[model samples]
Each structure stands twice: as structure tokens, then as C-alpha cells.
Target chain A: MDEEYDAIVLGTGLKECILSGMLSVSGKKVLHIDRNQYYGGDCASITPLEELFKRFGAPSPDETYGRGRDWNVDLIPKFLMANGLLVKLLIHTGVTRYLEFKSVEGSYVYKGGKISKVPVDQKEALASDLMGMFEKRRFRNFLMFVQDVREDDPRTWKDLDPNTTTTQQLYNKFGIDKNTQDFTGHALALYRDDEYLNDPAVQTVRRIKLYSDSLARYGKSPYLYPMYGLGELPQGFARLSAIYGGTYMLDKPVDEIVIENGRAVGIRSGNEVARCKQVYCDPSYVVDRIKKTGRVIRCICLMDHPIPNTRDALSTQIIIPQKQVNRRSDIYVSQVSYTHQVAAKGWFIAMVSTTVETDEPEAEIKPGLDLLGPVKQKFVIVSDYFEPTDNGLESQIFISTSYDATTHFETTCLDVLDIFKRGTGEDFDFSKVKLELGEEEQ
Target chain B: MASVKIPEQKVILCGEFGVGKSSLFRRYAFNTFVASNSRQSTLGLDHINKEYTVNGKVIKLQLWDTGGMERVASITSSYYKFAEAAILVFALDNPASFHVLSQHLLDIVTYAENAKIFLCGNKLDLVGQVPQVTDADMENFCEQCHNLISATFRTSCKSGEGVEQMFAEIARHLVNANRSRMELQTVDKNSFKVTPPEDPTEEPACLC
Candidate 1:
């Protein structure tokens, strides 16, 4: 059969799916194909509990675990920030109609052999057990400055050059101790390492504000999760693409990516030839074009109890700063239970993930996993992270980066926007997206 | 916390591609039918919640439309996890789409396993003009495919025939199944309210 398209995407990862949806909305005839029959390649959620065990090659769960149908376990657990870029994209693209979301209950950070709630607002700050009275005053003042200081207003700057001054100086200016700085940076700003301290303070300041604003939106926490799992996200975007005239073929494999004179012209899949001007795909689709970046270790734990000292939050995130654990990168522990219908009633799923630093990859996430009181069943995987070395300018073949160790979508959204820019050579203007998130699904 | 519980049903529409599955989906869901050609082919898993009052109980149908192109993994992995009902659609005018009826039935049995599956013969308007698979022929084919088809219908999105009746019958089945499950839930001691046992698992998303 002879068919042609303006662009074709080769993988069903979240990053690739977002690009496909955005491209289709831009009025391009897009064709999306995934070698795997399911969506969200490495980042898929396995349902029926038995299927997950099958994927891990483990034995079927006993009757002690509830019915298999009640579980939708994400192999890679992550939470979406309420006011983060991903939510904005969801709203802008009008994918919200296809899904329902519940607010997460708490945001916690690990400190001094224990876990404590993040003080997201003034009320929480005054009652925070992590800080003393005087320190709370200093921290409050610092937060007030952050709340009041507009980057554009000179008076709000208070003589700190956000563009030129490092975040370390800003911390020193407020005399906020290191312990408080750890939670604010690692949990609030959600930075993986201390490197942001060395960079300009503007982005960090903005991130903190974003976190607080997001927390304020939902109050309990700044996170919202779909009823099923993160797997629903790719499906939502896939529906958007289809609404805009994009073609999809799952379980379709590419025999050859026909490059005519160093440009992606067409794809050959089992005698079906569909021409396209450009191609977009995840790193696994085109290995030669990407370079090995690093490795990530993810531990998925099934527990009968909530994480210790999280105030028994139904859904929560706990960040372990690198300095606290004497490591290079921070560890993230995210937990979800039946409240989101991801797991069976009274069952919880906690995942501890971190960037692999040494050969003993499993040992790196020990601090994060220790928070879970008693895990009934655990599945662990270590995968290499990759990035496209060349930007696909020469070949018109844009490739997405591998999924990272972090349990959030900010970094994933960044990768999506970056690929969108490289593929279309224009920034994804959010204003161009109609404010129609409330459009009736029917 | 005050919460209003809504009864929900997960229904999957499974069949081969280009069998007019999207039209049936848009018809049953949107209640606004655009012809078969203008509608875009479904991508991935497309689902919508349509509320129906069955026997005085407001039941929400969580209709899942598989792109009709997904392979075996999509079936084995995610689609059948909690599906209480499945509507396997086939085009009446195109017997080729009907040829795969056995395969779809086998998959629904193997994956969905216990779901109440109904067969729908779509494009009834095109059936006579396009020269024909009879309604009985479709039922005979379903019976040959292991006697698994729970009910059958002849629907046409063009003329708005049988589409409404097909869904109404499916809803009746779903409501009956749900009521039995609820009754069984009360009698069965295994049923619990998913108490807050110090920790919960239904989780959501957070920050960077």
C-alpha cells in the first residue's frame, strides 16, 4: 500500500507520544508506530498483577495478595507536579477530558535517619518539627522574600542579583542552615544534586515558587495522579493525535528507515511503504545516533503498610538529598496505594530509584528503600540511560532520551519540549494551544 | 471525607482494524455520528465514560476502544485487567473483518477470560448494497467460534439502526453483573473497604 506522511514517530514512550501529539496538532500528517504492542515502552504499567510477575519472570502471586484485576503497577513509578510543565501540556492539549486525577496527600523529605513533611506554606512552616523557633523565623523570612520577590521588580530583588549570584549566596544571605537548605533544594526545587547551588539562583528561585504555588493549588501536595497509572498519560496524548488526523500502528516493526541523501524520506514496514519528511523516536529506536549517558536503578516494592513517618499519607514523595546519604545524586522514594486505584485495596506500592553511581547498583537505593517498613514483594531493574549525540539536523531523524531515574515528569517534559523544538525548529508556543481542557469528551 | 460512589463498568471494543470500530465508538459515545471515512482511526487505547440508568441504577460505562491494530501484547498486558464486558465488533459488509472473528474471540477468552462478550455486526446499511453476510450468518459464525458470543446485534452507524439497542442490551448485562457482584461482595467476607492500614497505595504524581 502506498501512503505518505509529513512525519513518523517510531516509539511509544511518553516523550515520543508527546512529540507525536504536538506535531499532529501542528497540522502535520503524523504516523506513530511502536514495536511493542503496549504504550509507554520502558515506562509502561503492568496490570493484572500476574502479568507484572510474568514480565519479571517471577511466580504468580499467592491468594494472600488480593485479586489480580485490582492492580495497575507501574514498573517505573512517578508523580506529576500539579502546576508543572507536564500538567500545563496536559491542559493545553486538552487531554484532561480523557482522564481523572486525584491529589497526592503529602510531600516528604528524608533527614537524619527519619522522614518529615515538607513545610509548603506558612501554617506548615510554623508547625514544622524539623526547624527550631528562631530558624523558623529566618526560614519564613526567606520564604516571604521568595513569595514577594518578582524577578522583574528591582525592589523585590533586595540587592541579590538573581542572574549573577549563585544560589549558595542566596542561602547564606538568609542565614538558613544546611539542613533546611537540603529539603528546600532537594524536595522543593526538586534538584537531583547540589550543582544547582553553583548555577544562577533565578531558576532555583522560580522552581521553589512553582513548587509552593503548585502545593497551594491542591493544598495537601502539589501532585496529581491519574486513576489508573502513568500509562494513561500516553493514551491521552495518543487520542489527541488521532483526533488531529494522526495514524497509529502498534505491533508494527520497521524493516528499514529509508534515508535518501542523509534525510529521512520514508519507512518500510513489512511491505507497507509510508513516506514521511522527518522521523522522531526514542533512543532504543535508533541506537547508533545516541550515546550512553548513565545508568538508573529502580526498585519497585509492594508493601502492606505505608512508609514509616510519612503521617500515613495515601500518596507521597520522599527525597533523600545526596549530602544526607553521602552520595553524588539524590534518591527518590514515591509511594501510591488504592486511593488512586493503582493497587488493590489496603495495598501500597513504593519505588526507590536513583542514578547508578557504582557497580553495586542495588546498594545505591538502599537508603530510599529502607523507609518502607516491610515490603512484601519487590522487583528491581537497572537500565542504561542514553541521549542523542547528534540533534537530527543532518538526517531529519530526531531521537528522544532514555527515561531517567527521577520519579517525576518535569525532566520528561523538558525532553519532550526539546525534541519538539529540534523536530519543528520552533519553540512549542503554549499560547497557540487553545484553552479547551474542559471540552466534553463525548 | 464525604464521597459519592458511582458504579462503573469497564467495556472493551475489540476487533481488527478498519472494521468501522471508531464509528461505533463515536456513535455510542458522542451520540453524534460523522460518516466512517472522515473519522480518524483510533490510536492506542481510547476510552470514555458514558452514564446510563439501568433498572433505576446510574451505571457509568468505561468504554475502552482498542485501536483495533494492537497486537497480542496489548491484550496480554493491560486491556483485560478489569474488563467486566467486551463488545467484539465486525463489519457485516466486509467478510474479511469477519474472518478474524475467531481470533478476537480466542483473545477475549484467553485474556479477558470471564468477561461477558457480545458480537455486533456493524455497517448494516452497507450489507445489502455491498451483497451480504446475513444476521444469522454472523450468529452462526459466532457459534462456530467456540460458542462464546453472549449476544449478537446488527448495527448501522449510518442509519442509526440497532446501535442504541445493542448498547442498551450490553448495559442491561453490565447492570445485572454489577448487582450480582455487589450482592456477592456483601455475602463474601473477603470484601473490605480498603481501609487506611497506616499506609495506602493509590498514588499520584508530584514534582521534579
Candidate 2:
């Protein structure tokens, strides 16, 4: 209790856990503490159907819900891209040993009041009903250009500057229609809205390439979900930290930050004081350090069947682009069923989330809800979205932002990597990490 | 080639700090103990795998060490969440460590109600000189726990006594319990089966 550490992290959220694991593996002495008894602060997967009901102040579930222990419901569910930084981090830190992942079955896009799979390859592009014959040929050529466009090779640029050329110009060059642009930008690139269209085409192109590459890694889909829901992610990283000599404490009260001269020195949780040179926390721990930027509404629904129009996929992700729905923000729907061990044998868990743009939050998700045939139960949560007021350059009190409404972990990884740079003053060197799990597990 | 899947059980070593939990783990993981080190010097207790054969079937035990988190009442719930078993370690020469078993028992029962608890009295090498906790004391404690403890053992990590026997007993019990629960399910049906690693050939660095 009296030992000083290099850094003290508050919260067991996925972001903090990843940072803790990274810091510990880098040989920094880290003391991680969480106020709640459980791991994964906001993104925890509540188990035993009763606890989910209890937390939402709902009545007890009947026997039809099955054994409560069989269900692992994620409060803030998000999928992992196969080639994304989060997967790389898991492999780099060898945290994959503590977890099991199943590739999400399908990736779909909602347009014109119907959902269709987002085609990534030439075969899917040709067979896709989302585009016409000439449009498919144009989209296929566009896909070929995207696959060949190397960042360093000028021969593949096709006379278009990836950095200076806007996405609108690039789409026009390929003659991609408005509908094609919507899915390409929203579903494939996973942007929240059309704001990226005017920025440079390189980012959106790279995102599409990533989508294709990740899809190639796993033939069914580009996204992966852990077997027992996403709650396993934080625990996996926490175990990685423990393996690297990081100390962890949960169900502990954080009374004060113990600042001196406007710099965080340590944490005092009662009579005992654990001193640390720097403090890393989520936005909730230090309320004064954060400001609400926006609000996100999420509705978790329990169903007896897979989401409609998903080809009976046991797990899938659907993106409702903002423009198609006549809204300012995109709506994300993700579902996982008994195959992932997240629900009972015949049950499926689906979540609808989006950045709130209206007063009627529940009504905002009606479009996504209509996609699910019949929901057995539902829980709605509206939370304030937050980000740190300033980078922790002076206070040495690094903080993470709230989870976004995106159905994937790209944005979350960016926030974590940014905070890692601010807290440690070193870029996370990815080239040095190798996939160590393969040799270790066998 | 068909691969056989050995069921992995997460076994945690927990109790008061300095009660030789790390020492026991070090002894099991590396088969070595440093006598001069008075503090916990373990790098981490990450998946120290030990294979035990039970009724001709092999089971893998993934051992976890608390790393002194219990000293500050900070053992995260994730540590106990999916644990198949827990070894409550107490020093035989320290009665104070024995008295706190109830608190640890309470936590394990609350968080890991399905976990099989085992009582471990460490520092058996010092029993000849000063045995602060007696056999009767352990019996009373086990009774208070309402027979939640499946087994008990006294081990000396220094002398390598009863350590292997204790772990082997845990593996045998777990294998039996699992076999009874699942009724010899196929390897593919095993819980927590590792997902096949991604193809590194196609997965280039994210351009973003």
C-alpha cells in the first residue's frame, strides 16, 4: 500500500485495461484500480439474465429466459476488425491466450428500407443486388483500384492524388452512384457520417482496403466478437497486466487525487496512500477534467431469433448510414447469439446505438428495431458522451474518452493510442511486436 | 491431422500477502524458490500451464497468482469470475493469515459461487519450529465454510513437499467434475476453445 508506482490507472474499462497492459509490458510499474467490483467499467457484460433485469430495475425473468449464467450481455457491445489495432494490440501483448474469438457472420448496410450485405470482393460486387450491372462493373473497377493503390507506389495512384483529391472527386472518377457512395463511405469505411467525404480520399480508401484485408483474413466477415461477449476483452488485458507485474485493485473507493502544485502525485483511498508519478483514468473518475461533448443512446434488445435479412447469421453487424435514414448520425445494430455463448441456446442479443440527434431517443432507434422481427425484451440507456478538456501535458493525469456509437473498435483504439502517447511520451512501436500466441498455445 | 483439445481450467492462488502464494506459484511454475527474497518478486503469474492426466485424459491448469493485490483489498472480480478452482493459501506459522480465510472465503463464494475451493497451509517446513495454526484450527475453519472446500493440503514450497500432490488432486477433481457436468462432449464443444489465428499473410499494417 505504501509503494510508489510509475503510473496509477483508475477504471477497468477496455481502454484503461489496454493502456495498463501496454505500460506494464513496457516495464513500467502500474497500479490499476477500479471503483466497481467488476472489470470493464462501462462496457461490462452483465451475466445471469436476472442481473441485467436487476440493473435496469425490471421485474425478474421467467424460466423461459433459461439459466441466468448462460447469458453474457454487453452493456456497450462493439466488434473487433480482424486487421484493426485492437487485434494487433491483443496479439502484441499476448493477451489472446486469455480469450477466444469468433468471426462475426456478416456485415450489412441499410438503404431504401432494406438491409444488404456490403460487398468487398469482385465476386460479391458482381452478385450484389445493391448495385446495377454498369454500377457493379464501375464498383468492381473501383475496388480493383483501391486494392492496388499502394501509399508509396505512384504507379497505382491512377493520376489522382490520394492526399489532395476529395472522396467526391474519387467517386466521380469511378462513376459510383449515390447509393454506392453511401455504403462505401459508411459501411466499408465505417465513418460516422458524410463529413469524411470532403476531407481527403486517402483515409476512406485506406479504410476500405482495411475492410477488404480484414475480410480476407476471415472469409465470412471482417469483424470478430469474443466467444463470451466483449466483457472478456478487459479481463484479458487485465491478465496481461498481471503477467507483467501490474497490480490491480477493484471494489475500492477513490477518495482523492492527492494533487500538489496542480500535478497529480498519488491516490488516497482512505487512510492508505499509494503514490504514483502519473495518473491515468477514464472521464468519469475526474469529473472536473472532462466536459460533455454529446450524448449517445443505446438500446439492448433480447430476441429469440437472428436479425431479419441477415441470412440467418448467428452474429452480424448492420450500419444505417445517416444520409439513408435522413438523420445527422449513423445508427449501428450488432447481434450475437448462442453460438457466441453470449445468450441461451435459442436466444440472441442485439443492440441498437447511435449519437443522439433528437429529443425522442427511443423513437430514434425505431428504424433499427424494426429490423429485428420480434424482441422478447429490451433495455434503453442514454448516456452523456465525454472527452477530456485538455491533453494531460501539465497535470500528468491522462484520461480516456467515452465509448462511441460505432459498431467497431477503431475509434476506441485511436483514443487509447493517443492517451498512451500523452502519458508515456513515446509512440507505441507496433513493428517490434510479433504474434506470440501461436507458438505459445501449442 | 486431428488436434486434441485439452480443457483448460483457471486456478487462482489467493490469500493474505506474504503467505507464500507467489512462492507456491514459483515452486509450481519454475520448480525453484529463493529463500533470501522476503518480498514478492514474481514477474507475473500468466498462464503457467501444468498438464495433469486424469483417467487417461489430460487437463491443462492455467494457474493465476494474486501478485499482492489482496493486501489492499483490491483483488478484481475478474480474477474470480470464471475460475474453476481457488487455492486459499495461509502460512502454517502465521495464525493471522489463517484468521483471514473467512474473508477470502466470503469473496470467493460471492463472486465465484461455482468455483471449487481448496485449503492450502503453506510453510510446512516451518511447522517443526513453530506451528501457529493447528489441524483442529483448519477443521473448524473448513466447517465454518460449510464444506465448500473440496480438499485441503499442507505443503512446503521450499522442500517441495505435498505441492505436486495438491495440484494433481485439484486436476483430478476438476476433471471428474467436468466429465460429470458435460458427459464427455466433443473437443469442438469445449468452452473457451481458442479461435484459429488470423492469416498473417493477408493482414498488413492498418493504413489508418
Candidate 3:
């Protein structure tokens, strides 16, 4: 307990676990602790089907749910994009070996009161039913243009300045209709709202290109889910940390974060004080340093059938754009079934989450619920999303933001990278991380 | 480092802090024991990947340690997931560790659900000096756990007595228990591959 460490992480959340693993791999001694007995902190996946019901204060599950151990229900479910930064980080850190992944069955979007597959590439654009014959060609040309626009090559810019052109301008150049822009913006780019349309088009172009590139990698959707549940992710990183000599403590209460001269020195857990140079934790640990930005409402629905109009995909992601649902925020529905081993046989778990903009949080996700046809059980959770008001420079305490309403881990990865930079005062170098095999004691 | 692939079973070592779980792990995996510097050398190793031949069949057992994180019941439930066997170690010189065996058994059955429990009374060399935990204590603890424990072993990392036999017994039981599952894995074997094939979707070279 007296050994000094480079960093003391306060939660076992995915972001904190990843940072701890990375730091440990870089040869920095780290100590990670959590108050809860289980891992995954705020984003843990409850198992046995009974625990989830108990956590939500719902009635105990009857025998109809089948074997209790067969279900792994994630509290804050998120899908990882195949070409997303998170997957790249997994491979980079060599955590991929500890876990397995299955590609998501499809990526669909809700439009015209119906769900349809999002057209990412030129081929999908031409064959898409969401668009008219003329709009399809236009959207295809748009996709082709996006594929060609390179950040380094001026010739691929098509006379439009990548830096100066707004997303609205990019849309107008290809004559992409309103509906085309809606699905393209919400589904492919995964924008929470239309705010990005007013910003520079370079980021949007890169996002859509990323979406297409990820789709090209797997041929289905760009998303990938772990075999068991999202719970495996944090544990995978924790194991990586442990292998790299990072210590972990769970079910241990962290009484106080010792701060000296406005900089973190260590953590005080009872009578013992474990010293560290810096501290990393989730927003909940340092509530005074965090500001509540908004609340996200999520409904975990247990169903016997796959999401309607999804071709009976075993796992899929569906986004209901803000405009279609006539809301300020988009509603995201992510479905996973027994194929991924997250549910009992013939049982599917669909989660509908979004930023809470109204008083009736349950009513806000009604559109997402209506898409599920019939649900066996539902657990609703409304959690406040927090962001750090104080960065690590002064306090020497880096805090990760709360999980957002997005179904993908893109934003989560961005937060991780940002926190890494702020905590270490250096950018995360991808090239330095070798995809080495698991080392063994000889 | 590329070796013949075998079935990997995750076997976790659970006990109180300083119960010589890591020492037992080191004695078996590295086959060396350091009384004073036991914890330092093993901190760098997450789990030991040891290949054992049970009934003429090779099985790779991933022996995992608690990293002394279980001292305050701080070990994560993730550590129990997918575990095929759990080695519940206790110090024969300390009756307290023996008394807490029921609590550890409760945790194993609660989290692991299906992991075969193997009771281990470590520090067997200390038994020569008036033993604090007698054989009756072990028998009583086993009776309380009742039908849950697969087998029991007494070993000392110092004298290396019964150390090899304990692991062999574990491997033999696991091989017998999961023969069909191992055969199924033999039909579809896979070695580790870290990198994906040259990502074809990667953009072409472009000079700024």
C-alpha cells in the first residue's frame, strides 16, 4: 500500500481502464480502484438476468427467461465501429487477444415511419430504396466525391476547399436532397443533431469516409460487438493493465483524493494512503470538478424477436434522426441477441437511448419502443451526463466524461484520446504501440 | 514464440493476501521460490501459460493470480468469468485463512457458477512446527463446503512438496471433465494473429 505509483485511477470504467492500461504499458506504475465489487463501473453488463432486474428494482424474472446465466445485459450498451478508434486502440494495446468480436448484422436508419439500411458506399447508394432513382445517382456521386476527397491531395478536393467548405456547401454541390442529407448526416456520420452541417465539411467528409471504409472491411455494417457483452471491454483492458504491472482494487472505498497546493498527490482509502503522482477517474468521483451538461435516458428492452424491418438481424444498430422523430436529439436503438451470447436463445436485447430534452423521458423513447413491436421486459435509466470543468493541469486529476447517448464508441474514443493528451501532456502515438503476442513467463 | 496451439483454460488462484497464492503460482510456473522477494518478481507476470500433459493429452492452463487485490474482497467479478477451475488457497499456518474458505467458496459459486473448486492448504513445510490449522480443521471446512470441492491438496513452495502433484491433479480432472469440449476445439484450432491483413480500404499515398 505504501508503494508510490505514477497514476491512481479511481474507477474501473472503460475510459479509466484504457488509460490505466496504456500508462502501465508505457512503464508507468498505476493503481486502479473502484467502489463497486464488479468491474465496468457505470457501463457494467449485468449477468444472470436476475441481477439486472434487481438493479432496476423490477420483479424477479420468471422461468420464461430461461437460464439466468445465459443473459448478459449491458447497462450502457455501445457498439464499436469496425474501423473506429476504439478497435484500433484494442489492437494497438494487444487487448484484442483476450476477447472475441462478432460483426454487427446491419446498420439501419428510421425514415418515413420505416427502418431501412443506410447506404454508405457507391453501390449501396445506387441500390438504396430510401432515395429516388435520381437522388440515388446524385448520392452515389456524392459518395464517390467523398471517397476521392483526400486531406493531403489537392487534386482530390474537386475544386472545393476542404478546410473552407461547410457541410451545407458540400451537400449543395452534389444536389443531395433533404432526406438524403438527413440519413447521411445521422446514420453514416452519426451526428447527434444538425449542428455539424453548419461547421466545416472536412470532419464530416472524413467521418463518412471512415464509415464507408469500416463497411468495406466487414461487408455488413461498420459496427462490431464483443462476444459476451460490452463488459468484456473494460475487463480486457484491466487484464492488459494487470499484465503490465498495474494493480487493481475493487470494492474498496476511496475516502479522499489527497491534494497538495492544488495538485493531486495520492489517494486516502481509510487509515492507509497510497501515494501517486497523478489521479484519473470518472466524473462521478470528482463531482465538484464536473458540470452536468445534460441527461441521457436509456431503455433496455428484452424482446423475443429481432427489430422489425431489419431482415431479422441478430445484431444491428438503428438511428432515428432528430427531424424524423421531430426532436432536438436523435433516438438510437441498438439490438443484440444470442448470436453474440448476450441473451438467452431466441431472446434479443434492444436498447433505446437519447439525450433527455423533455420532462417525460420514457415518452421521448416511444418512437424507439414502437419499433420493437413487443417487448418481454423493459428497464429505463436516466443518467446525468457530466463533463470536467477542471482539467488535469492544475489539479493533476483527469476525469472522463459520462457515457453519451450515441450507440457507437466514436465519441467515447475521442474522450479517451483527449483525456490521454491532457493527463500526459503528450499526444497518443499510435505507431509506438506494437501488436505483439501475449508474453508468457518462461 | 509460435508454438503448437492447445486448449486454453482460465484457472484463477483465489485467497487472502500473503497466502502464498502467487508463490504457489511462481513455484509451479517458474519452478522457483524466493521467500523475501516473492511478490516483486511475479508482479510483472499477469498469468502463467503453462502446458501440462494430462492422460497423454496436452492442455494449456492459464494460471491467473489475484495480484494481492483480494485482500479486501477487491477482486473484480470479471476475474471469475469463464474460469474453468478456481484454486482456493489457504495458509496451513493460519486458521483465519482456513476459516474464510467458506466465504471464498461462496464467491466462486456465485460468480463462476460452474468453476470446479480445488482446496489448497499451502505452506506445508510449516506443518512440522506445531501447526495452527490442523487436519481436522481442513476436514471440517471441506465438510461444510460439501460436494462442491472437486479435490484438495497440501503443498509447500519452500520444500516444493506436493506442488507438482496439485497442479497435475487439477489438469487431470479438467482433462477428464472437458474431454469432449477439447476434442471440439481440436477440430477448429486457432493461433494468435495480432494484425489484420493490409487494410485494403486504406487511402492511397498522397503528398501534402
**TM-score: which candidate is best?**
2
Cα deviation in Å at residue A241, candidate 3? 3.4
Q: What TM-score fits each model?
A: 0.83, 0.89, 0.88
Query: Whose TM-score is higher: candidate 1's or candidate 2's?
Result: 2
Candidate 1 Cα outliers beyond 4 Å, as residue runs: A269-273, A429-442, B1-14, B25-86, B93-118, B126-152, B164-208
Residues A86-188, candidate 2: write the lDDT tens digits: 8878776767766677888888999899999887566677788899999988887887788778777888899998888999999999999999999889999
Tens-place lDDT per residue, model 1, A1-442, is: 2578999989877888788889988888888888887777876777779999998999999987898877888877788877788888887777765566777887888889888888766777888888889889888888877777777778889999788889999999999999989988898889998899899888888888778767755668878777778887887677677656677777878887888998989889888888999999888878788999899899999998898888788888888999999998999999898877778889999999999999998988989888898899999999889989879888999988888877679999998898888888999976655544213443
A94-181 per-residue lDDT for model 3 (tens digits): 7776677777888899998998887655566667789999888787788778777777788899999878989999999999999989
| Model 3: lDDT to the true structure | 0.83
What TM-score does chain A reach in every model? 0.97, 0.97, 0.97
Quote the RMSD, in angstroms, for model 1: 6.1
CA lDDT, every model vs. true structure: 0.78, 0.84, 0.83
Candidates sorted on TM-score, descending: 2, 3, 1
Candidate 3 lDDT over B20-65, as tens digits, reads: 8888888877788888553463455456678799778998788887
Each candidate's DockQ: 0.11, 0.27, 0.23
Better of 1 and 3 by TM-score: 3
Compared with the true structure, what per-residue lDDT tens digits does model 2 show for residues B114-172? Answer: 88999999999988754699988999888987899999999999998999899999999
Candidate 1 chain A lowest-lDDT run of ten: A433-442
lDDT-based ranking: 2, 3, 1
